[model samples]
Target chain A: MWRDHLTEIIVFSALFLLVSAMGFVAARWRAPKDMAHLDEWGLGGRNFGGWITWFLVGGDLYTAYTFVAVPALMFGAGAAGFFAVPYTIVIYPMVFLVLCRLWSVSHRHGFVTPADFVRRRFDSPVLALLIAITGIVATMPYIALQLVGIEAVLKTMGVTGESALARHLPIIIAFAILAAYTYQSGLRAPALIAFVKDSLIYIVILVAVLYLPYKLGGWGSIFDAADAKFAASANPNDGVLLNANNQLQYVTLAFGSALALFLYPHSITGVLASRNRDVIKRNMSALPAYSLLLGLIALLGFMAIAAGVKPLPGAKEGSVDSNTVVPVLFDQQFPDWFAGVAYAAIGIGALVPAAIMSIAAANLFTRNIYKEYLKRDASPAQEANVSKITSLVVKVGAVACIVFLDPQFSIDLQLIGGVIILQTLPAVALGLYTRWFHRGALIAGWAAGMGLGMWMLYQIPNAATGRKHFGGSAFPLADFGFDTKKTIYVGIVAVLVNLAVAALVTLALRAGKVPDGVDGTEPDDYFVDESDPRVTPGPERDADSAREPVA
Target chain B: MTAPDPEAPEAPTAARSRAKDRSPWNWLLFIPIVVPLIPAFFNGDSPRLFGFPRFYWLQLAWILLGVTTTTVVYQMTKKKRGGGR
Candidate 1:
């Protein structure tokens, strides 16, 4: 099988290596005076312009996992899979309203992570620790899922081997290159490489949506094919159109996913790395263009069904991996060389986000965990060193997740990751707007929401892979004693429960006259822009100030 | 920690008033989020366009709606040049 696709293997290898080389050279793309500081290494100097931020954030959010999985969901589940389309569409307006404030306040305070903002806003190290740990935990499986994206493309190219080590060798090699360049150049590596990734993704998706549909008859026939496939399927919920039972799930899942998209540390990393508030605002308006792309991408799943593309067999007997649907479709339809380009698109797409996520998670650990607890007096250089090392370690752990655990387990964990990260909304997203929620209340809210989310996820079952628990994100309304069979997104329920707990606890604490933590930020801090007099200077300036004699 | 500037008291109030003036436009952001979630607006298969179902094409239209709405709000609320409040 591998021998049959020499043209593809060569093209994929050439492009993959080209991006990896670009990753190393990116260290000097916008070289800072001090390479050892967090701002320089972890954030690309916090000065990415509109174009870079647009591509970087788009590449970060629309991961290779999304490229593979969203369509795969459409291939398997039908209309429910289209939830991703609305999910991406709705996220921009929501973030446009909120994230500029975060960017402004973060610039004012020199905050590298959301936990940093939480730590100061609430003046509670414990709460910051919770946010930081949740971020790292939620991010790990997400990075692993990026690996799953690359692996799907590789598998479709017939790159598998007999031994376990052999099967994962290609992924390990690709990630090792990613980990190396990310270590050398930090956030700049992914920032630089995202250009290539997005170009490939746009070209491949546009081609597939246009050319494949034409070849497979037309859009009407594609929809008809999907409708017929779902109509003949055993499950009543599967179709091109929403059913009564699944409609609630579709809406709630889309909404929940939109809310959860930016809460992840990686999304925040991209947002904070921008040059200014206007950059964020412009990107917010412009970023939905990717949603248009994502909508087209999601339709590839239906196109696959229309083209009669069958999925490759899974590791287990009689099971098939639906994640391979898009890759397999590309393989069967496109010429060998173009198929390799699509494969490289997916492969490089994985690398860009994996690098950003590791950097984001590493920043969380170094700032909130390592500096706050382990070594309070660590300098900026030491902090950068820790983050650089932590990023490598995180990637190794993500690779281990793919190697040791079943890929299905990582997908399940990624679902739970959205829920877990949304638990931070009250503390991170809302706290940006108001500090009314008390510190203790926020922590309690997080715990309650996380606990309930896990419980709810455990109750839902996936009939496809025969998993009894932790199978999917759609929770049944009947489980809450409602008579209806309609299911809703678990994240939506968990977040509402989280908000209620936080609000009630806040009220209780206020009534008891419990002293809330000091608010370290002022209103003016949230409005500070680039080059503003009040904006915090970089660590180099702080160092210079410390070295100066007292007046 | 520095001594309070003479302009401090009026600065926040001016900013506050400006925010209040623009707050109505911010409400437009909710249009995109809310409109797409309403099943009745887009839950049907009739009214196909370009060989696509109404449910599918309308969702794509919502992306355009969101982009346009956000762009309008962004333009309306954009801060003026020369650092004016």
Candidate 2:
């Protein structure tokens, strides 16, 4: 099998090794004087200019999983899958309005994680602990899903074997390299590598969208083929157009996902690493260009259908993994060498977000869990050391998730991941804007939201996979005694329940004269720019102080 | 730097108030979020563009609209600097 695809394998390995070398070299890209602080290691010294910020955040948001899964979703479910386009479209405006506040306040207060901000804002370590744990839990499965993206490409490249060890060995080797560089270089590794990842993705996708249509009839025939296939299908939800049953799910899923996008610790890690508010503002407007690319990417699903691309067989007999559709599509149509580049685009694409996500989760652990609770007085060097180690542990756990559990299970958990992170919205996103909720009330609201979200998810059934429950994110309204077959997104429903509980609890607490947690942040803190004198100094000054001889 | 005293009287009131004032331009952010979500507007298959259905083409168009709205808002609301970087 390997001998058959020697050309593709050689090209893929060459590009992969090139990026790994760059990952190690990235540690000295900006060459900070000291590398033993959380700011230096975890956030690229927190001074990335506009272009780096653009690529970093863009690469962070549009992961390899998105490259594979969005097209796969488009292939399987037709119009319902197109929700990702609107989801990306709606996120930039929300980010523009909301996240700059988070960036400014986090910089002003030296808050490393959203939980760090929550800890200071609500003045409650317990609440901060909840936020931190939620972020880390929601993130692990997401990192595992990135592995699924690479696995799809590998399977397409014929790197499979009968033994389990043979199947997972390549992934292990790739992630070990990723873990080493991320541990050494931290956020800088992914920041520097994203340029290469995005460039390859653009070239491959632009070429595919332009060339594939011309090869397989045209866009009109592609749409016609997709339409005819779905029209003959039994599922009411499958079509080139949205139907009455799934329309509500489409809108809510789009909006709910947009709300949840930046709430993820990785997204915030990308945002807070920017040099200033203007870097964020400029990137917000510019980043929507990726949405255009994403829209084109999603259309690859229809292209796959037009090209008659069939997914490779799965590990189980009589089962096929739809995730392999795009990879197989490229392998079948493109020549041997260009197909190799497309595969490398996907394989390398996985590395950038995986590095950033592990770093983000590690930052949450170090700041909120290890430092806040484990040792209150841990020095900066110690905190950075703990973070570097914790990032390695997170990657190992992500690998374990892929090895022990079925890949389908991780995808389901990622759906729940979005829902779980959205529960933090009231605490983190809204907290950036207001201080109305009591700390205890926010905790109660979190419990209510999370409990309801999980229970709703448990009630969902995936008919295609033949799973009874915990199968998907679309919860049927009929469960609530409604007569219709319409389903709403589980995250939207749970978040609403969460907000109502929070509002009522806040009112009762206020009427009872319960004292609120002291807000550690000032109003002006949210508007501080890079040139502002009140902004916290970067790591260089701290490194200078540490290098001084003891008095 | 030491942590600020939580009870200290608020300084930078001008900057605070300026940040608080809701610019009308900021309201443009809602257009992208709200417009694409209304199902009745872009749900049909009529008026296809470039061999694409109305639903397909319109969603892509909404992306362009979102980019434009964000760019306009960013330009309008950005604080004018006295000295360029």
Candidate 3:
């Protein structure tokens, strides 16, 4: 059995070696004149220009899980999987305006994390701690989702087994290599490897989209097969087209996900790593090119259906893993050598974002939590060291999420993470424009949103697996008296409740004579350019301090 | 520390002018975002193009439209941001 996939294993190992070498060597690439600082280690020295920002932000947003899971979602559910397309499309214009301001403010203040901004903006350590914890909590399941994507590809190559340790040992080994490189190189590991990961994915997807359809007749036949499959299934809401019941869920999920996407610590880290405001703006227009790629990749689900792909039996009895559909489809349809290259693309795809995410999370801890609460006078080198160790601990927690929890549940937990991140929008995103929300009100709103979102998520049961609760993002609208059959995305409802609570509480606070937090940022801070005097000091000071150790 | 090389002259006057033109153009950014959120417009399969359903093809088209809108807005606002300074 292993001998048949020898070419695939060999080719996958070769490319994996190439990426690991790049990860180790990246410690010295661009050499930063100073690796001892957070700006250098965590945010790529905040000097990346257009092309690097494009790829870094692109690779950061679209992950291995996107390559594996979006298509898997399409194969499992019908039109709802396409929500990723519109969400990504809207994210560009939506963030184009917001991110430039965030970049400007962060550059001026030398903020390493989003919660750093919240802490200063709100002047409330408790609220800042909440945001920091939320960032780490929201990111854990997302990193686990990336591992699930890699596991699906590994399972297709016949590397899995019946025993629990046998199934997870290969994953543990792969993540071990990832953890080592990331701890050594920090953000540079992912920034360098993103170039290789994206090129492989582009080639694999271009070939698969063109070749798979021809092998399975054509797009016409693919849709017909998908339509026939969905029509015959017991669920009426699932089919080739979006029914009236799911249309609202699709719209709300897309909009809610669009708002939530940029608010993540990793996505913001990628934006803040750009050299200037213009790089951030130009990338917003260019980044939608990845959305186009995502739209094409999502069609692989329909192609899997046309090719008559079925899920491999999972570890549990009577269980089928929907995540395996795309990987197994590639194995059946492509040549052995090409399949190996595709598998390596997906496996390496996990490395770049996982490295970035862990770095982003570690930055939040070091800047917002460690320095803020633990040691207020920590030096820059000590901060860098703390972040490096924290990254390793964060990756271990993510691995635990996959090993102990169900993989399907990890996907739903990712959506639940989305709900958790959306609660910060009023504080982080809106705080850029105005200070009227009242930091106390923002904290209260966050609590209400988190409380309601988790409660609703607890009520949603998995229809396919017959699980009790916390299985998916869709909740019935009829519970709120809209329509008995209709379901809406839980995130949209929870965020609206968050905003409403924040608004009402703000008014009451104002009437009762509550003091708003002192604004540390100047009005001109929001529009600072690369040439601004405020940004010049941080990098120049870092460079001088870096020479102290070298001399 | 060494003195950093200055790119050009900048003052509060140029910054104020840029901020004035920037705020109104942000409202125009909402067009590409809000139009796509209403699913009723593109839910049907009657107007399939190139063997793809309406739900499929129109969503892809909107991705391009969103990029175009952002590009147009960026071009309109970027000159005032950099040129006046």
Candidate 4:
């Protein structure tokens, strides 16, 4: 069976090689005159226009995980998985208002990381450090999820499992190549590679959505098959449609996920790299084109059912490996050559965002951690070098996440990361519009949110594996007695705690006559455009001129 | 370095920029927000569109709706007049 896939492997490798070459050559695609500067390397010179920004942000946001996991969830659990479609839909409007303001302020101040904006906004390095740490921590599991996506594809391709180490060898090699180009090229590598990733994904999804249903008789038969299988399952909540019990989970999950998606440093990396607010706005609306694609991609779960595709032999008897359903489905339904294209799409889909994610996390470390703490006098060149090296370290941590942890846990940890990152919303997202919350209050809010979020996540356990913890996002709303079956998203619960703490603490701090921290931003900073004269960086206005160079 | 205090006097141009920032077109941003929230109003499976469940098809339609509304808002608000910065 494995040997028969030789043609698929060759096509997959050929496309993989093509993208890897593109990743390396991207270093010179938009050659910066002074490539040594941190902004130039860390952010693709922070000047991408609407078209490039669309692809970059699309590729960054709709990751390989979307390709592999969302449908997998639909295949395994039914209606709950479709939450991703609504989440992606609402995300643009959610971010459109907030992110443009962020871009304006960050650009005006020459801030590279969101933590940089927080530090300047609240005048608290400790708060900034917490935000920075949260970003780095949240990003690790996310990058791990991407690796899980690639590993699933590789496993489906029959290239894994010679030995324990041999199983991960392909993943390590793929990411190592990712790390090298990202180290050499920084944000530019992913920006250039995004073009290819998005194109291949569009082609594969467009073809699959059109071709799959016809092969399976039509949408009617596909839903009928899905409904029959789900109805026979033990879980009463499982079905082809949402039930009273899961409907609230769907709404809260979609809303919470929408709120949390752009808070990640990688999403911000994509947003801040755009040339102007207009680019950001234009891309936000247009990028829903991917959501349409995602909706179709998710239906592959139903297609898998209609095709009678089952989990591979290695999966535990009588249970499904949800992650493998889509890959196995494609393998069963498509000819070897097109299946190769589909597999390559998922594989390369992982690389683009992983590269961008590492760069974003590295920027958080260098700008907020290394520069702010260890060496305030670091030069631009030094900063760039530190970020490049940190990108590599970040990738190593991601590889560690997938290598050492159970793949299921890595998936759950992603939700936990969202819970952690949403804690920053009070300080980072709100601070863009108001600084009324005292810095002390914001810190307390973050602590409350992070603490409560982790506790809830720890309590949820997997029924299938009998695992005691890190099972999933749906936590029982114990406070609402007799409704234990009704669960809310962990992120929504945590952010509520964050907001309550912030509000109470802010009022108390105000009553006590506590002095607020210095606000470093001006009102005008939130509305500046590229053509604005104040942002044009004259000799006297050079944003980086004040920092003293350190050896 | 910290800017002085929020209590410090703002320039007239800055105040004017703040006022202008509240464009009527900014109100259009709520469309994306409202469209997604519509699912909660009619969350059921009975009204299946072409065999796709209502809960499913409604959300998918909103995806395109979100894109269209955002595009209109973006076009209207893309050009900025004189502002404080």
Q: A1-551 in candidate 2: lDDT tens per residue?
A: 77877788899999999999999999999978989999889999999999999999999999999999999988998989889889999999887868888988888778789999898899888899999999999999999999999999999999987788889999999999999999999999999999999999999999998999999999999999999989888887889998898999999999999999999999999998899877988898899888888989999999999999999998678999999999999999999899999999999999999999999999999999888778877888998999999999999999988987899889989999999999999999999889998888898899999999999999998888889888888888999999999989999999999999988999999999987867887777787777765565675345434432211
Q: For candidate 2, give the DockQ.
A: 0.49
lDDT of 1 at A381: 96
Candidate ordering by lDDT (highest first) = 1, 2, 3, 4
i-RMSD per candidate, Å: 3.4, 3.7, 4.8, 3.6
* Predicted structure with the largest DockQ when compared to the true one: 1
Residue pairs with clashing backbones, model 3: none
TM-score of chain A of each: 0.98, 0.98, 0.97, 0.96
For residues A1-551, write the lDDT of model 3, one tens digit per residue: 66788889899989998999999998897777778888888988888889888888899899999988889889988888999998998888888867878887787777888898888777888889999999988998899989998898888888877788888988898889999988888888899999999999999999998888888887778888999999899987788888878888888899999999998999999999898878988898899988988999999999999888988878578988787888899899999999999999999998888889999999999988899889977888899999999999999988988888877767777878999999999999998888889888999999999999999999998878898888788889887777478888898889889999999999999999998867766666677778765566345655433432221
Worst lDDT run of 10 residues, candidate 4 chain A, spans A542-551
Candidate 1 structure, TM-score to reference: 0.96
**DockQ of model 1, rounded to 2 decimals:** 0.53
**Better model by DockQ: candidate 1 vs candidate 4:** 1
Model 2 ranges with Cα > 4 A deviation: A540-551, B1-17, B79-85
Give the alpha carbon lDDT tens digit for every residue of A307-385 in model 4.
9888664434565567888888888889999999999999999999999999999999999999988998887889899
- TM-score against truth, every candidate: 0.96, 0.96, 0.95, 0.94
Sort candidate 3 into its docking category: acceptable
Query: Which ten residues in a row are the worst by lDDT in model 2 chain A?
Result: A542-551
